[model samples]
Target: MDFFNSALGKNITFVRPEYFIITGFVGIPNMKYYYIFLFFVYFVSVLGNGAVMALIFLDHNLRTPKYIAVFNLAFVDLLGNTVLVPKVLDIFLFNHPFISYNDCLTFLFFCYTCLCMQSLNLVALSYDRLIAIIFPLHYQVKVTHRSMLTLIASFWAFVVTVNLIIAGLLTRLSFCKSVVINSYFCDHGQIYRLACNDNTPNLVFGRFLIFLILWLPMVFIFLSYSYIVYTLSKIATFHERVKAFKTCTAHLSLVAIYFIPIVITFTMSANIHPNARIINLSLTSIFPPMLNPIIYVLQTQEIKVSLRKILKTRMQTKVMAKKVIIM
Candidate 1:
């Protein structure tokens, strides 16, 4: 905790207006309490995505390729938020906002890993939907449980490797300040800017990796969804078309959340006009997770139904316990 107790730790640095200023500007402006608003969003995210995960784990009926993909999406969301939100609450509540340099780097590594994994998971999910839609004949045979398990394992392995490489590269650099990160969590771009050495390689490699993780998958997803829509158009009946669309609805909403902000931020993070920088970075930090669960709940019927079921089960269990005590 030497780093935490250091002089650098006590002083807060907002690290460019890019972090919090625009969040105040465009994000729910009428609300007097921004942290409270974020708390509500975090709570709903946990409850909604946690319920989605529980349904996927507990209900055997929902264990199909489509739902398995949804489960993976929920897993990514849960892990990412768990890392990000609690630290934010700690900062807001206790003024114990200091993260040790090592801890900051570690958090930055995992945040990048989880973010990448979230994108990879979405690509996997969308691909599952694409196969189920375009090539229905081989859907089961192609996306078998064993194959999916292998895919998930491979995805994690690849992501961990990427994180290791990036972290190894970053370790060679020096950090001189404990400047409090402007954003709630230790995001990579902010931390990288603090490195004392020449970060040109880091910048180049980071962007390349981002392209692979985000934009490349985006291109593949666009192609897959395009064909999926094309195939759906061939269906004669409107009900069948709607059913097909319904199957992909949740995945589509997820893709929108996973890609939109990253594309916006990555495109503009470097050499942007002073006026627009704040707005661009805030899109990455504040927007996606805030709306993620709302999109999930609204897009996925199973999540809604499962949330109701979980709530009802808890209520019934409580009532039965009360009756037992009465007796």
Candidate 2:
């Protein structure tokens, strides 16, 4: 452990195995290409999610509960990308990657918050979909604007409280071990492994938390969707049912894209070659942000039309003002 504090340790600031994928790609023969690719991907993800969030907020016609849920999903995705992507981009720029203890804690907090928010968003969206499709008549009354806002507010508050509890528990523990985290971001699960104190409490509590936050919602999502399908079968209008199913396609796509990688990454972190942590994380984090916004924009016709309408209206307004000024 003293080696970590030595000049040698200072030179090798990153706490990862030499064989880590990031080490190979970032350290490799042609490092320029890797950095360029990383920058490009991050840029695309940021712009894409940012645009989706903006589009949803800007388009007044998209103020319904369905699109509102999509907007919230975009917001969570953007936040998740922000918490992880900039630090990852910085790592690409610097050689001696040393994040201070406080920085580590901060990163862990943001990462946890973003992830929990995303999971909660999915849960909320699942319920939203179940209601919209399964109980269309009641959706207006049950998922009223006020009700949606309340749900969103509660989801964010609950997630924050959960994160605070975990972070508070983490702060009391000291890290006497080497601080080399194998992954790009400071995931709580990964960070706990580096702590010197007894983590049995942390592990038990964390796993219980993991079960509550991750698996429970997933179960609900599945059950809700199952009941939704059953209800859809009872609807007589084939065309109406088809249209509702189309609406679900976007949400289902997002769920699959997000959950598959998350489950894979979690499994890898639990019991696989630690060297692949970066790959697993990139798959889970990097790719989803880029794809989620694209998925929503492409799948939803209303958003595209509304965006075009807004752009046209702005252009026409500018033209009219210019003509008046010239006169």
lDDT per residue for candidate 2 within 1-327, as digits (tens), equals 453335223443323322112232243355566556667767887888888878878887888876777788777777877777677767656654667666766777787787777777888888888888777789888887787778988988987887777877666554655566666666666666766655566678789878977898889988988898888788789987787789788878888987888787777676865546555666576677678888877988887797788889999999999999999
**True-vs-predicted CA distance for residue 91, candidate 1, Å:** 3.8
Quote the positional error of residue 218 for candidate 1 in Å: 0.9
Clashing pairs in 2: 15-180
lDDT of 1 at 176: 54
Please count the clashing residue pairs in each candidate, in the order shown.
0, 1
Best by lDDT: 2
Return the TM-score for each candidate structure: 0.77, 0.84
In model 1, state the lDDT of residue 112. 77
lDDT of 1: 0.69
Model 1 lDDT per residue over 1-327, tens place: 343234234553222222221011233244336556656767766776776777778877678766776677677776777776566556555456566666766777777787888888888887788888888898999998777777877888999898887877665544554353455466555556775545676788788887889888999999998898888889999999998899787778778876876677667667675335544553454455546667767777876787678789889999999999999
Full-model lDDT for every candidate: 0.69, 0.73
Number of the top-ranking candidate, with TM-score as the measure: 2
